[model samples]
Target: MRGNFITLEGGEGAGKSTQAGLLAAWLREQGTEVVETREPGGTPGADAIRALLLEDDVPLTATAEAHLFAAARADHVENLIRPALAEGKWVICDRFIDSTLAYQGAAGKMGVDTVRAINASAIGDTWPDLTLLLRTDGDTGTRRAIARDGAEIDRFTNREFAFHRAVAEAFDEFAATEPDRFAVIDGRNDIETVAQEIRSIVTERLK
Candidate 1:
């Protein structure tokens, strides 16, 4: 049997990384082998691309950025995510296809369908079985992200409020379109409360 694939998504400071860790831990405690990873990463080739996309100062047009993301995702899904799922290990990813749709596609003024088509070639049919969208207000998420990263903010995080707001709206639209595949979680709650809600959802849905 193939294991489940779960992806967590949200704008900056939405606590995706934190929730991903907690969710992976909980799943492991339930006797499931888990693999926790992040987008534009999880494999060496993808990690190199991640550096260029997030950490480096490279300038890229929206189309170029979208292509780079798709390239990294191709490597990640093929080399790491696919093998782990084949081995029956539950995969918990901090971010995935939805992030690209939200960030570069909608917020960056590129069409979501266009970006989706580009990634379709990269990931094939390996979509996540469930996606947790940790929804948060744009202002609040921006503040939290700034505080969390301090001087190390990434390229996306450095964008203006309008861009972040667009990203949030894009996420909401995606969730609305695919309610079966996405669980919209209010991210303003405390950590434990959010984690428990996620655990409950996973149990009810995946089991």
Candidate 2:
């Protein structure tokens, strides 16, 4: 049997990493073999690319940035993700193609269709079986991110409030369009409550 693929997505500080960890742990306790990973850095090559993409000093155009992300995803999918899934491991990812679509396609100057086209060859049929879209207000998310990262914010995290709001809106629009693929979660609640909500959704879907 093929293992399930689940991706967690949202703007910065939406607690995707936390939920991904919790989900993986719960799935493991259920006797599922879980592979917990994050985008842009799952493998060695991808990790180097991730560093370039996130560094504050790396200057890249919107189109260039989007392509970089696609390249990283390609390497990550080919190297780590595909093999794990082939072995029947539940791969829980912190982010995936949807992040590129939201950040570069919808929020950035590249547009959604263009970003999708760039990623088509890379992702192919490896899209997530379920994407947990964690929703939080931009301001609140930013506050959380700032509290977590402090002065060490990355390039994406340093973007203006308006830009972050646009990213959040784009995620909402994408989830609205792909209801079958996405499960929206209110991320403003306590961590335990959010984890329970996600666990319930995952349990229902895995059945």
Candidate 3:
């Protein structure tokens, strides 16, 4: 049987990476082979793309940005994600296609359909089996992200509050549209509380 592919998504500072790590550890305790990774990275090629996308100071058009993200995702899905899933290992990703939809599509004014169509060629049909949408207000999330990153905040995290708000709204819209695939979790609570809620949701939904 193919193992599950789970993706965690949210605005900045939603604790997706932390939750992904904790979830992978919990799944491992249950004797399930797990691989935890993140986007726009996972494989070496993808990681290189990620540095360009996130760290570089170059200005890219929204369309170009979307394509770069798709390129990175293509590398990640083919090299790391698909191979791990083929071996019956649960794959937990910090972000995936929806991030593209939210950031570049909706917030960046590129249109979700356009970005989705672009990603279709990149990922084919390798959608996540479960998506945990961690919810947090824009101000709180921005503050937390700034605190976490200090002076080294990424490009996305350094965007205006209105842009982040748009991203949050886009995520909510996505969860509404794909209720079956998305489990919405409040991210304002403490880390442990959020992790516990995620564990309960995973246990009940994926059992």
Candidate 4:
């Protein structure tokens, strides 16, 4: 069986990472094999690019950053995600192309169409079969992120509130436009509640 690919997307602190882990575990409990991973650092090469894109102090142009993300994703899909799926292992990714679309395309001012075009060549037909868009208010998400990461925040997380809001709005617009591909979930609830919702969605999709 060709394995399913699922991507979790949301604003910072939406608990995508946690939910992804929970979903993968639940899938395993049902005797399904799962490959749990994340972006933009899923593979070794991609991890290097992730550090450059996230940690380097030098400011990269929006277009440059988008290209970096594409490059990292290219490596990740080729080296890890694609192989895992080919072997009949469901792949649960914390973030994926949708993040690039929301952050680099919409919020980064590059345009979603352009970012999508750029990434098309990178990952080819590796788009997720399902994307769970975790929804949470900007203030609450930001507070959660700050609390989780403490004083140290990633480059994207350090952006102004307005930027984060734009990212959230972009995710919403994308979900609305592609309702079949996206399942939006309330992310403000406790972790167990959110996890249950995600698991249910994934289970239904599998059926």
Candidate 5:
């Protein structure tokens, strides 16, 4: 059986990581061989590249930085995600191409065309069957991030309020354009509520 691919997406403080973990655990309770991964890192070597991507003081140009991220994603896709899927496991990705589009394309103002081209080249239409976009307000997201992450904020996590707003708006627009593949869920809700929303989407679609 071909495996199911589910990619979770959202802005910085949208609670995607938390939800991903929760969903993975829930699936394991049902006896599924779920492989949870995330962009900018997954495998060993890919994780090394991820450090460069998320680290501050790198000083790379926007386009160059985007290229590196895409390369890392490509590597992760080939070495980790695909193999896991072929083994009939659920591949739950924390973030995928939408992140690039929102962060670099919309928030960084690097143009969607470029971001899409790179994303296409990297992921090559091998998109997730479903994408859960966790939606949250900028202020709420910022507070959540500050509260949860303590002092170790990555480069992307350390953006200004306007930048997060742009990211959230971009994701919202992207989901709107691709209604068939996306589901926008409120991240402000409690964990079980958010998980229920996500569970409903998956059960509905996969059923």
Candidate 6:
């Protein structure tokens, strides 16, 4: 049987990382082989790409950034993610293709279809079996993100609130389009609540 792929996606400060970790632990407890990874750095080569992509000093065009992210994902999938999944392990990703659509395309105003085409060329057309989109108000998201990593904000994060708001709105629209593949969880709650929700979703979906 093919491994189940569960991806968590959302705007900054949505608590996706914590939830992903919690889900991984729970899956392991259930005797599932879980491989937890994040976009842009799931493998050695990809981690190098991730460094360049996340640096605040470097100025890159949206297209250039998208290209690098896609490249990293291609290498990550080919070298690390795919093999682990083929072994029937649960693949838990902190962020996946939906992030590209939200950050670089929809919120960046680059056009979602274009980003989809680029991503499809990299990671194939199949969607993840489940995508948890952590939903939080943009205002709250901004404050949380700033608190979470605001001390070292990047060009992307330092952009106007309108940008992050756009990203959140885009996520909503994206989830609406593919209700089956997407699940929206309220993220304003505490970490334990978010983790419990994640644990429940994974248990229900993959159990």
Best by lDDT: 3
Q: Indicate the worst ten consecutive residues by lDDT in candidate 6.
A: 148-157
Whole-model Cα lDDT of every candidate shown, in order? 0.93, 0.91, 0.93, 0.90, 0.85, 0.85
Clashing pairs in 3: none
Off by over 4 Å in 5: 149-151
Tens-digit per-residue lDDT, 91-151, candidate 6: 9999988898888998877899988888886888445899999999777887788897435
Ranking by lDDT: 3, 1, 2, 4, 6, 5
lDDT of 5 by residue, 1-207 (tens): 868899999876788988999888888887888999988799887799888887877766668777877888888888888888888999999998888888888888899888888877677757888999999977678767877836458787787889888888898898899999999999989989999888889888863
Shift of residue 77 alpha carbon in model 3, Å: 0.5
- Candidate with the larger TM-score of 2 and 5: 2
lDDT of 1 by residue, 116-172 (tens): 999998999999999999999887898898997444688888889999999999999
**TM-score of model number 4:** 0.96
The residue-by-residue lDDT of candidate 4 on 1-207, one tens digit each, is 789999999998999988998898889999999999999988999999988888747688889989999999999999899999999999999999999999989999999999999999899999899999999977679778988844457788888888889899999999999998999999998999999888888878874
Q: All candidates' TM-scores? A: 0.97, 0.97, 0.97, 0.96, 0.95, 0.95
lDDT of 3 by residue, 154-194 (tens): 78988999999999999999999999999999999999999
> What range of 10 consecutive residues in model 2 has the weakest lDDT sum?
143-152
In TM-score terms, candidate 6 sits at 0.95
Error of 2 at 168 (Å): 0.5
**For model 4, what is the alpha-carbon lDDT of residue 182?**
98
Tell me the lDDT of model 4 at 40: 90
| Model 6 spans with C-alpha error above 4 angstroms | 149-151
Residue 23, candidate 2: C-alpha displacement in angstroms:
0.7
